[model samples]
Target: MFTKRAFLTLLAICIGGGTAYAQSDPLPSWNDGAVKKSITEFVAKVTTQGGPDYVPPAERIAVFDNDGTLWCEQPIYFEAAFALDRVKAMAAQHLEWKQQQPFKAFLAGDKKALAEQGEKGLLTLVAAAHSGMTTDEFAKSVADWLATAKHPRFNRPYNDLIYQPMVELLAYLRANGFKTFIVSGGGVEFMRVWAEKAYGIPPEQVVGSSGVTQFRLDAAGKPSLLKTAKVQFIDDGPGKPAGINMIIGRRPILAFGNSDGDHQMLQWTMAGSGARFAGIVHHTDAAREYAYDRPSKIGQLDKAWEEAKAKGWTVVDMKQDWKKVFAFEP
Candidate 1:
């Protein structure tokens, strides 16, 4: 009974403007261009009553990828940068890692050495430093590190590298009754710990990769999940749809990402019968954020480029679309 026509009608019905009133500019800092237009149009459609493209408030599920979509991901992912730092800091305690391939590469102060290990090596490094601690412990460590670690280029806290446009988009969507979620390849616990503080998205709204975790009753008689080497979920590529299916249950009307890992997420969002939207945040502003796509090893923007065009997904070229990179980057 759920036909495309019914979905499209619902989409049209849910695109009406809500009762939100802005004292100043609704999106004051947003650049006056396609990013703003697309966002405004989407909001209007979803919030305007009697509009042909209106979508229901409850059905306005908009999911966004964390790294390059919401913030900078190069020269490498922020989490990867954290992982590298962790390897170096903990290297003193784990002397065995000093002789290891990726860890040795990490310890020797050569990023390329770990590159030689490729994906498997990177995963090994992530698991080694990221696991072995309770989820809260890992979160606290991340919070502690982010409090001091500065970007190599911008000399600002890693958390400060988030994109302003995306931030506005998140606020705008939520203001219009769109329930936003972060569906990323980054560790679920890793992002869940801080996303709410920074992006206003709660831990329950975040879905991402996670290593296996064991349930244990602690000294205080509390149950918690302990991180382990065993991979619980990858949460990338096709796994994105799987995660959304499992966690959210309902398909999203909109999805945003920046690389091949997000292709399946875009595909899944577009496949649903409705006024669905998919956008790829192309990293084309080296000055503002970063500009390496096909050649970049981490969060590479290759196939997603093709998929964006072929599927008619909105491709956000940072160089042209965004006037600002971060909230405080003035």
Candidate 2:
């Protein structure tokens, strides 16, 4: 059902034996297989002009869970490590924290003590370190730490361990007119500092858990939100979809994640009326990255992996599916 002009345009490119128009094919580094095929097909249908399956650019929204999907989330969550480091480094300012239960545990580098504190202790650490600073200061701290922090196993900067195939998929989707948004459990401010350079996703497009802040003029009298030790937002589980709806407005045509935290995000994306796609990056490559799934304390898979097959969702197995892990040679 092509109009005359549209038909002639594509036809001419085929005819003159000219270098053919790119078909938004195989996402460069992605292996030529089912995963790549599904991703390409989904993107092509949505972005092609005048096609019956075409969706307008405004509605061409894609949501991604940042940690395991875009990079590595093994051994522990990246932001959790950030919290632990912040507590130890800033302990000088608050000697009181050194005596506190979880803070003492964190300060001592006692993994067993930390485990004893569990979720409540983790929350205590997060609230303490993440709050009490301005947004700009928080972002700078994250950038500074990320620059120096090495993965315990890899001994490379955490940011450098980003998955190669996923990176290609992001760029490929963008070439097909999709706007990508990060819906992660990590702090929004933490990811915003490096997301643009790391993922080609702008700061405004990233969404994540956040703490409360208040307007306070610094010594320079510039307007800014100085952080407060209160939970303003927690963009995980059901909160992810709600955050996306509130912030991005458009429902996603595609969604990718690696944990149960993103279950709701996939739900929101697939709930879109037509041609929606959702996938999960299951960490099954211990050699290349880390072998982990449902049992892993940090990025637990459980329900996401179970529901993926039931829902016909593509599961990217790190060992079998991805031809390579980090784009840079490990």
- Top TM-score prediction, candidate number: 2
lDDT of each: 0.84, 0.85
What tens digits encode model 1's per-residue C-alpha lDDT throughout 35-78? 66776777787688888888889899999999889988776778
Worst 10 residues of 2 by lDDT: 17-26
Query: Candidate 1: minimum summed lDDT over ten consecutive residues — where?
Result: 16-25
Please provide TM-scores, in order, for all candidate models, with all chains considered together.
0.87, 0.89
- Which regions of candidate 1 deviate over 4 angstroms? 1-24, 110-116, 218-223
TM-score, cand. 2: 0.89
Query: Which residue runs does candidate 2 get wrong by more than 4 Å?
Result: 1-26
Error of 1 at 119 (Å): 2.9
Clashing pairs in 2: none
